[model samples]
Target chain A: MIDNLILGFQTALTPQNLLWCFVGVLAGTVIGLLPGLGSTTGVAVLLPLTLDFEPVTALIMLAGIYYGAQYGGTITSVLLSTPGEASSVVTTLDGYQMARRGRAGAALSIAAIGSFVAAIFSLILLMVLAPPFANFALKFGPVENLSIMILGLATIVSFSGESRIRGLAMASAGLLLATVGMDAATGTARFTFDNVNLLSGVPFVEVMIGLFAVGEVMYQIRVGAAAPIRTRFRELLITRSELRRSIGPIGRGSVLGFLLGCLPGSGSTLASFIAYGVEKRVSRNRSQLGQGAIEGVASPESANNAAANANFVPTLTLGIPGGGTTAVLLGAFTIYGLQPGPLLFQSQPKLVWGLLVSFFIGNVMLLVLNLPMAPIFAQMLRIPYAYLYPIILFTSFVGAYSIDNNMFSVWIVFVAGVAGYFMKLYDLPMAPLVLGLVIGPLFEKALTQTSALGDGDLLIVLSHPIALVVLALAVLLAAGPSLVRLLPRNTPDREREPAGV
Target chain B: MSTLIRIRGNGEATVYAMLALVGLAAAVSGAFYGVFVDGGRVGPGFLPLVAGGLTAVLCGWLALRGVHGRRSHPPGGPADGVEPHLAEDINPVDDATDDDVDISGRTRRERIHNLWKVFGLTLGAILLVQVVGFLAAFGALVFVISTWIERQPLLKSAVIAAAATGLIYGVFGLFLEIPLPGGLLGLGTEG
Candidate 1:
């Protein structure tokens, strides 16, 4: 393990890998700070640039974007009240409130520090735990693999958000969409209205960009833009009392985040929500919640960043992507003609270790890039709405076009954007739709493989221990959200100021 | 039913009904797929069938919930009608100003109109791609988005559009070598 760490450091420290990592982090920060452009879009847009580099360097760069964007996302959430990504939604509750209260500087700084600390801690955990987890992958057969995939699909249940029926519907739609391409098992066309492109299935990244980024941007545009509120750049440090308040939550979040990060289906997003939820649970001082609690910003921020790095554990060790972005990273592995499993450690030790080591370095780099720039991003709110919206639209188009170099993909962004806006207006959860889109194919393909093995007996899903345990987990995942809602409603009218612009 | 619907009240209830109807249609479509298709016990349509039925149930639930909300809080009180914060507000200030104005005039029609425009713009962009190609389609769409949706001044919008088109051409077409549709203006032709 020590040797692996040293080896990873050596590979990550090289000039080429470092350079790409820098580029990835830099681009990620800017894109993340921008509204309607999340880390996914940032990665998708820049994916073309990585094609020329070595697979390790490219992976490191993309990984940098993934983590850096998580850090950068808080900038908009803190300064302008606009959540740069879904994870930042909780951040805006306190972060933007902090800005309104003239503690924007402190909010921005703690967020950066919190992100850095969680990321570093999570990376260390990744180094220690990934090998064992990957080894555990050896235990998984076709039945277990299929069950794990089913468990991932079951996450749509968790995201149901006041409506299990809608959540199930969205997840099913995603599964149907997933079945579009030519059937790998029987060579039968499943649902591809025989359009050649449909024969290959819809690109997951394209669908994601459409659902989250484009749909979000259209919503923002229709709502019209806000002038970023300017605040006096006072002390940038957290107060002693504020620091004292944050320490417990941050500490709790670090531990909680690492655990959730270890899970296959739950990764950073769930970790953030759970961290925030737990902080609320543990708090004795109730008034601090809806009214600019520093812990509110720190807990989720740390968890999400940590979870972002932690998700690599499953991907690196077991060849399973616990989340959408990691799934794309997995695609990178296959693209390079290498599978990501225990064999990867034996055959491509440098790449595996280098990627892990680079994450630590990237987290540090992200803090340095973000802390001072937080206030500046807040000032992006100062930019007139006229200039900002055009730039937003322009970036969306550029990002879309860059994906496959085809205009059809770009058009999909607009169409999805429009569809998503309505979905949002109707109070549908976008994440389930996206999560479904992402995990659907994996579930379908795994189910097909299991059935092909003549494990069609529905009882097999219950009889196999791992499958049974996972099915139990699926039931729990389905129930967790309702339990959360039923939990004593903290505040009937929690004064939620919409994150600025 | 009409009396109940009327008691459910105006534009808001109508929107809910429309959404419920859409959900019902989707449910029917999904049920048809599930009932008809059978390759194995677990066919391809099973999931969709489940999703559609679930969606229909949820939509019905939502409509009922809306009705309940209306009943619980009758029209015209503080608890009734739309809350102040939730009210449709749209501020039509095109010029970006530092002075933050309360531009909160988002209307039901305006929201719907934007959706229609989005549908049109997307389909248009796809069609335009085949005719004039990526750059042209992109430029036109960006131009339309900037000038129309955003209501930017003509000159500013044009400059943004031109610069955006050029940047895309430079990065994607030249640097990345992704080969965006050249349309009538092939790569060799000088702009």
Candidate 2:
């Protein structure tokens, strides 16, 4: 291990390697900040540029882009309620709420801090436990995966604000919307209504841009922001109490993100969502979550960064892609004339360690770059609503068009924006709907796989300990709260206490 | 009949009813696809059957709750119960007309009018994309929005519109090379 660290340091600390790392992260931040682009697309587009470089150096740079985008994606989510990708969608729930209440700087700052802490924590785990985690990841089959998706469904209860029923209805609508495309198993189109674009289902990214950015901008215009949120420089900085409060969520988020992220196909997006749900279930400031708690900003942001790092574990150790970006990064590895797997680690220790080490260095650079800029980015809110919204509208439309170079996405944005406006008017939560849309496909695939493996019995999971344990967790998550409420209270005072609070 | 009338008139109840209708349609379609089309396998319709059925029942329940709550509470003021659809943060002390009005002194009607105007203009711009091209159409959107609705100076609005268009050009047109459409005017195409 000591020799490996020395070799890793030797490889990563070279002038060219460090320079490329910095360049990669800088490019990644820009790519991620744009509304339509994300880590997978960014790394794919830039892969050819690094083909001439050495394998270790090129992998280091590409890896930087992957993790750095996780940091950049949060910027827009906090400031604009425009998630650069699905992973940051949860951040919009509280981060934008914080910005509206004049704390964009604090929201962005804690995200950066939590992200920095999470990346370091996950990287150490990645370096030490890659082989073991990869083996464990293989144990998570269709049955276990189905249970996790069920667990995700149970977490929708967390996204419900004052009204649980309304949230569930929205989630149902979202799930129905998600089933619009072709059925992977049957090769049958369910709800496409004969439109070619609907065959791919409603694009999640465009829907996010519409429902959050365009919808939010239009709502602000109608309701009228009293003025731009103005704050002093001192107030723009995160308060000490805010950081202290974030400590628990950051720790919890890191663990949840790492565990989920280690599983191939779960990705940082699911990790972030599940992490936020866990925080809502356990945090002391749970009630403040939808209304802009600092823990809200910290938990999901930390989880995504941790998950982004953990994504590499399965990719490096098993030669299996962990998520979309890692899939592209794995492609880059093949392009660089390197084979990835258990044996490759022994053959290519320098490359693997160097890349892992570069994740650490690149994240440190992102923290340095993002921390002070958090307040600077918040200064954008000072631009008056009238002028700013037009610009945001322009971006929203053009960004939609750019996503697939299709006019259909633009229409989706407009309709979703209108829907979003109505939702705001009715005080309906959007988070649960987005979650339903995200996990809908995964849920269906898992169901099909489990049924196939079980020969339609669906009880094969009972025979597998891991699957059984996971399904039990799902059942507990879904039904435990209600059962606990049914428990008898021992004290007369407690029993007599108002159920209102 | 009275409950039906009340539900139609109540925004909260009406929204839930609409959602319930959608859910019902989805559930029926899902059942059709699963049993008739796919022969009852756990295929595409399985999730929709579950989710859509859940949505229909739950939304039906919520719609009833909305109507009962509104009926129990009169619509006049704070002396009455909470308004069914008003945002939680909103104070019901204001007059009914002002329920959705802005503190900026803009009437509800005026704001809704403005919202329609913007929506129409954007919708028009998107339709005009093949003819006038995305750049010109969006530029006009910015110009009209800033000047007509926001009441900015015409010259300033034009400049803002141009700058906004230019930024779009630089980002989508040049850097990303998105192949933005250039229609009759033949402008702003990276290709």
Candidate 3:
């Protein structure tokens, strides 16, 4: 581990890596702070721009964008009562209240501090746990891999919010879309309709750009932003008492977040929500929550940031994405000509370790950038949504066009954007759809291999102990919500929020 | 049935019904592709068949549940419908948002109109891309969206459009070496 850390620092501390990391985090912060854009859209829209760079450098920068958004989303939630991302949704409850009480600076500062602490804590956990997880995954066969894929799909059941069926529908839609290209098993075209572009299948990067960036812009256009609460620069500092109040929540949130984040599909948003809920139940100042308690901001913020890092655990170790953004990142690995999964750790140790180490540097940089400059960052809220929306649309189009240097990709963006708009309108879960798209090819390959191993019996997955256990777990995850719903309820339950990206 | 349809809400139910059709289409296509190919190997369409079939069933179930299903709001969640914060997620899509000005019906229509306008102009830009070229066409779309949809002043919108175009040309086209569609202008390295 020490040797790996040294190698990571050696690679990450390079002048080029550091420069891109700074750029990535800065871009990510601005992207997350914007009303219409979030980290997923941020990474998707900006990924094509990194095509000129080394794969490791591009990934480091993109990963920076991922974590940097965690801090950036807190700003809007605190000041404007607009959350830039789903994870920051919990923050706005008490964060905005803190601002209402003239403690905006304290809220923002504590959020940054909590997020920074959480990032370090989770990154350490990620670093320690991911290698061992990858080692275990290396032992997995095709049958086991197929079952794990089922488990991955089943995790989407947890993202079902109030409608398990809708989530399933979306996941199926994604899988259906993935089957458009030529069949690798038989070398026969399946759903291509003789179009060469379709033969390659729908590119996940372009789909991501469409769904997150273009789709989000359209959504934000209909729902305009509110005017932000003005905060003076002098009021941005955190006093000792506020930091003291934040300690417990921050610690609690970090642990809760990292654990939830490591689970495929749950990701950071759920982590933040559950962390906030736990703090509400357990904190000594619980009654003050949702009012102006610093605990609310600190806990969710820490959890979200920690969860963001923990998301890398499954992503790096299992090649199964922990959320929507990591799903896109996994797609990026394929685009970069690198196979994603356990082997990646052995084949690309420097790349993997360097990326992990850069998280530390990036969070430290975010803390330094966010703590003092938050008020200045808040000023960005003044930019009208009108200007931002057009910029996003235009970039999305251009980015799509650049993907294949053809018009078809742009058309895909348009179609996917419209689809994404309706999907959001209907409250459908987007993450499962994306994960399905990403994991589709892998799942199919595993199934094919497993079937061959079982002499044409696809049910051969049932015989392997690991595969059986994984399949059982998948069944449990999928059935858990519905079973709970069927059981008699003792108390009224608030409908759960979608485990959004 | 009329009462049930009304209670379930037309817009969302229609969306689910359409998805069911899409799933049916996929399943049909997968069946055509052959679920089991030669040598008894799982064919290319097997998973799609399974997934598509599942999608159809799930969506069909959803189309029924909408008559009066439980809401997704957390039990103790704030009633203001504050949408969850997400960087990768959009803002204030549902019941959330303190935007007081949009309460009027006219403004609501105008907002929906803006969304349509953006979508339409993008289609127009896509067609125009093969004519004037990608950058210019997209830039025009940006300009029209800002001036027309957003109602930004002409000069400001134009400058914004120009800057955006310049950024795209510089970063993606020039720097990344990812060829942009040259279209008629032939500015991009299409060959």
Candidate 4:
């Protein structure tokens, strides 16, 4: 492991790789500061640019964007009271209060420090756990893989907002969309409609660009933009006492966030919310929570960054994405002709290790980049949406058009964008759709493989202990919400915020 | 039935009904491609058929529930309309402002206008790109959207559009070597 780590660092430290990492995180920070754009859009829109780069470097840059956005979200959450990302929403609760009380600098500083600490902690945990998880996953056959994929899809549906029915429908829609091309098993056209473009199926990247980037741009156009709040800069140095107060919250939040992040369907947003809730209940300074408590900013900040980093575990080791951003990364993996799963660890150890090592360096870069530069990035909020939306639309068009150099792909993006807008309007979660699309082919492949292995017995899944257990868990997870609603309530539940990217 | 339909509301019921129809169509098409084969080999359409069937069933259930929910409500009492899970009041990334606007708040004309302005420009750009080339089409899109929709100054719009076009041309066309469509302008090599 040590030797691998050394090799990873050696690859990551190359001048070209390091340069792209810097550019990626820098771009990530800028995008993160913009209220309308999050890591998912940033990664999706920027993915095409990396098509010509080395696979490892491209992955590194994408990872940098992923984690860098975590740090960027804190700036607006603390200073403007508007979270740049959904995961940072909790930070705004107390973070804005701190800013209002003239401790904006302290709030921002603690968030940066806590995020740095937590990211490192999660990365360390990822290093230790991912290898063993990948090794264990290597033993999973088609039956188990199908079961695991079922579990993943079920978790995503269950956790996607309030309407499990709608979520399931969206997942089904995604799965239907995935079956649009020539069937790999039998060379038969399923839903090509005699169009040559449909013969290859929908380009996943174009779908991503359409749903996330173009849809967002259109939404922004309808809802006018707001001016960013300006706050006076103060010393960014955290006081010793504040640091002391944050230590426990940071430690607890990191572990909690990393664990939650590893779970399918529970992304950083939920992790931050849970971490903040935990801190409020247990902190010695609970009275100050929601009223400028430094711990308020610390805990969620740390948890979100930790969660963001920990999200990579399932993505890399199991080929399951926990959220939208990782889904884009998964698509990128396919684009690079590499399948991410247990085999990826062995087949492309250099790419995998290089990416992991880049996380270490990327976090350091984010820390160094964010501490002083956050205030500057916040100024980016003033870039008028008048200019921003046009740029976003143009870039989205280019991205879609670049995929097949065909106008058909571009048209798909526009159509998908309209569909995405309506889905959002109807409160349908987009993450599950993306998750279903990315996982659909895999699910189909696994199902067919399992059926073949079982020799036409549908109950073959039950014969495998692990597959049976996983399917059982999937059933429980899918039903858990309804079951909970039926149970007698002792106390009124707290209003849970909707999940976001 | 009239009361139930009234309570369910036309908009909500129609959306669900449309979804069911689409799902049914998907299922039919999928079945046409063969859902299963000999020796229990799952055909290409097997998963799609399942997905389509599930969608049809689930959406059909939702449509029924929408009407049933209205029927279950007491007369003269507030109808518990079938509400999809509304996202919380917190501002999302795309919507950073505090306005709580919804489609219901706008007149049909207003809604159509907004939709047309946004989608029209986008679709126009898509169609125009193949005719005039990407840069020219994109420039026109930016200018029209910024000036007409956003109501920015014409000069500012032009500058922004020009900058956007340049960036797209340089990055995607030149740097990445992606052969963007040149159309009539012939600025870009045919991809």
Candidate 5:
């Protein structure tokens, strides 16, 4: 393992790879600060540009973007009180308060420090656990695989938002959309409506660009951009006492973030929320929570970054994307002709290990970039949406068209954007749909293979102990919350907001 | 009829119910096109059938709940019945400040108008990209959006549009060689 780590660092430290890593993080921070552009959209819109690079370098850059965006989101949340990403929402609870009290510098500094600590912690866990987990996953058969996929879907639906039913419906819609192309079983075209483009299925990249990038632009235009409040950076350094108080919360948040992030469907947003709630309950100064407690700023910032990095585990090992951003990364893996599953470690050791190592370097780069530069990044909020959105629109169009060098995909982006706009307006979840789309083909194949192995006996799933246990857990995940609500206990924990991708 | 009308009156619930109906229709179409297959031999339509059916059932339930007015506020907001979709903060200090943008004050008609304008412009650009070229179509889009919807000065709009077009063309075309659509410009191959 030490040898592999050495090899990873050697590869990641190459001039070209390091340069791209810096560019990726820089671009990621810019996108993260931009309202409505989350990591998923940032990755999707920028994916085509990476196609011309070496696969390892490309993956390194993309991973940099993913975690860099986590740090980027904090700038807006702390300074302007406007969360740039869903996961940053919790940060705004106390972060904005700190900023208002002229402690923006302290809040931002602690956030950067906590993020650096948590990212390193999670990356360590990922390094130790990913290889063994992949080896364990290699033992699973079609039945077990299908059960696990079901479990993944169940977790996504359950944590998607206040409306589990709506989340499930969106997932279903995504599955239906995935089934649009030629069927693998019979070579029969389903839902193509006889269009040649439909023969290959809806292009997932175009869908992502449309739904996330284009849809966000349109939504922003309609809402009209607000002039951001500017905060002058007074103290870039956190006081020793403030740092001392944040240590425990940061530690707790790191562990909590990593665990939840490893779970399929549960993501950084949820991790941040749970971390904030826990900090409030257990902190020595609980009453000061919403009133700019430094621990409040520290915990969620650490947790979100940790969770963002930890999400890589399931994505790499099990081929189950932990959330929307990783789902897009999964798509990128497919685009690069590198299937991210248990075999990826064996087949593409350099790429996998190099990406892992690059993450370590990327976090260091982000901490350096964000600490003194957060105030500068906050100035990005002042860029008028009128001027900025048109550029986003143009890039989105070019991104969609460039994928296949055709206009058909561009049209798909337009339609998907419209659909996305309405979905957002109606408060329907988007992450579940993307998850379902990415997992649909795999789920279907696993189910069919399981059936074939079972000789068409549907009950065969019940006979496999592992599959049965996973399915049981899926059932429990789906029903446990509602069942618990029926009990005569204190009113349930606050209904969580829909998680951002 | 009255009960059905009442149910339809709930805007949020109606939308989900309509979506469920669409899913049910798709499920029926899928079933008609292929057999469900017996004895664990799943057919081509198996996934659609299951997914669509489940969507319909779940969405139907959501609609019913909405009709019953059982909709509960999400957890982050205060426990007050005020819909926290854009609710102000609970802290008096934060609430007293009026720095946040209040788009919620915009009338529904104005909001819809803005949405259509943006959507229409994007759709126009998509159609125009194939007819004129990427740069030209995009240039026109930026101009129209800035000048028309945003009501910027014509000269300013043109400058912004030109800069944007040049930037995109240079990056995707000159640097990456993406082979963007030439269309009428004939600068590159018609994609």
Candidate 6:
């Protein structure tokens, strides 16, 4: 293992691979700082170009974008009250409030520090636990995979903000969308409507870009752009007491974030949301939570960053995507003709270790780039949305059209943008819809594969101990909160919707 | 009918009716594709069939909820109860006010007018995309949307349009090397 790590470092230290990694991380930061654009889009847009590079270099670059974007989300959430990604939604609750209260500096400082700490902690944890985790994952079969997906689907309830019924409806809608395209088991088209693209199903990247970026831009235009409040560069740093208040939450969030991140299909966004919920519940200074609590900023900043890096475990070792961003990374791996999984570790030791080492370097590089540049990014807020929206719209078209050099993708983006805007206006959360779009096919495929393996008997899925345990854990993940709420003396309080929905 | 009152008592009751109408549209669209047969016994339409049925049920549920005045209830009490239209933040009376004021209900007409203008801008851009191509269409789009705000002068609008097109074309096309569509009068195909 030590030799492998040293070899990985030696390979990644090459000038070309290191340069590509830097470029990926830099682009990721810029893309992430912008509201609406996210890690998925960043990876998707670059995936085409990365195809021409060496496999290890491409993997290293993609990994940089994955973690770089996580760091970038803090910029927008803290300064603009708009989240760059779902994970940073928690950051907006207190970070924006702190900005409004003239303590933007403290919030920015704490967020940067928290992110750095959490990222380092999660990286170490990943290094320590990855081999064992990979070994355990090798035992998984189609039945266990199906059960795990079912558990994931069940957790969709936790995201039902303000209205349980609405959340359920959204989740159901997601499931229905997932069922689109061809049925992999029977080789039958499900909902193609005669379009060739539909045969493969709705492009997950296109759908996500439409829901998050294009849709968000259109919504912003409809609401009218607000004039930004100006601030000095010196005003973006934290003081002694602020730093002290942040430490405890950051520590707790790091632990929680790493655990949640290790779970396949769960990533930084869930980690941040759960972290914030737990912090609010436990904190004695609850009143300060929504009103600019530094702990709020620290908790999610730490958790999301921790989760972002920790997610690599599943992607690198288990060959499963730990989240949407990792899925894109996995897709990139496949595009380069390399499969990701425990088997890959043995087959492509240099590629695997090189990518892993690059992550540690990327984390340190991101901290250096982000912390000192907080004021610079915050200054970006002064540029009115009128000026910014056009760039966003133009990029939407360029990015969409670039997929296949086709106008059809661009048209799809526009329509999806309009649809997304309406969804926002109607107060529907877009994340669940996105989750359904990405995870839907995987879930259906697993179910079909498992059932087929059982020779038409569904009961065979329960026979495997590993599969049973995973499914049980997934069930616990889905129902644990509700069950805890139902416990004696623990009446669930009215669930408050997380900010930046 | 009496229970189904507006919460803020501002918008037409037809808002709920409109939601029902959209729901009906979804159901109708789903129904059309639900029976489009394919190879399998279940076929391609099975999922859409279930989806359409679910939509109808959920839409019906939402309509029923609206009719029961569930959404009509104000923050303090039931619907139809008399209360100040302005937010407590603006009133400076309630402790809940703090600093955040809800000004969304205000400037309604201006917002609506701007929306219509934006719709006009979008339509014009789509038309332009066909006539001139992507570059010129995008430039024209920036001008139209900016002009819709009514604050910027005509010359400023043109300048903004030029800048927008230049930045997009220059950065994404020239720098990032994305193969953006060059219109009828673009610099060159090499771009």
Q: What is the TM-score of chain A in candidate 1?
A: 0.90
Candidate 1 deviant stretches above 4 angstroms: A231-234, A318-320, A331-347, A388-407, A480-501, B1-123, B187-191
Supply the DockQ value of model 1.
Answer: 0.20
Angstrom error of the Cα, residue A114, model 2: value is: 5.9
The TM-scores of chain A alone, one per candidate, are 0.90, 0.62, 0.95, 0.93, 0.96, 0.90
Per-residue CA lDDT of model 4 for A6-56, tens digit only, reads 889999999999999999888887777676677888898898889998999
Q: Put down candidate 4 lDDT per residue, B1-191, tens digits, no spaces.
A: 57346435644455556777777888988888877776877777788889888878877776676676642111111100111122222343333233444322433334346656879888888788768888888889889978886668999889889888888888988888888888887766565
User: Candidate 5 regions off by >4 Å?
Assistant: A490-501, B1-11, B70-112, B187-191
Encode model 6's per-residue lDDT on A207-241: one tens digit a residue.
Answer: 65566566666655444434344445687667888
TM-score of predicted structure 5: 0.92
Model 1 chain A weakest 10-residue run by lDDT: A492-501
Docking class of 4: acceptable
Instruction: Evaluate every candidate with DockQ and list the scores.
Output: 0.20, 0.28, 0.41, 0.32, 0.39, 0.16
Tens digit per residue, CA lDDT, model 5, A388-442: 8888888888887777888898889888887777665555678778878988989
**What residue pairs clash in candidate 6, if any at all?**
A105-A236, A105-A237
The i-RMS of every model, in angstroms, reads 7.6, 7.7, 5.5, 7.2, 5.6, 8.3
- How good is the docking of model 4, as DockQ? 0.32
How does chain A of candidate 6 score by TM-score against the true chain A? 0.90
- Who wins the DockQ comparison? 3
The TM-score obtained for chain B of candidate 6 when compared with the true chain B: 0.57
Q: In candidate 5, residue A165 scores what lDDT?
A: 66
What's the TM-score of chain B for every model shown? 0.54, 0.77, 0.74, 0.72, 0.71, 0.57
**Which parts of model 2 are misplaced by more than 4 Å?**
A1-119, A122-131, A158-162, A226-363, A370-375, A487-501, B36-40, B70-112, B188-191
lDDT of 3 by residue, A1-501 (tens): 999999999999999999999999998899888876888888888887777789999999999999999899999999988778767877988899999889898889899999999999999999999998999999899898888877877876654544556667788888887887987777878777788888877888889888888877787666655778887778877888888889999999999999889878766887887787788668999889878899999999999999999989888888888888888788778778887789988999999999999999999999999988998998898887778788888888887777677788898999989988876666767877888898888888888888788778887877899889988988987877667666564543233322321
Q: What is the interface RMSD of candidate 1, in Å?
A: 7.6
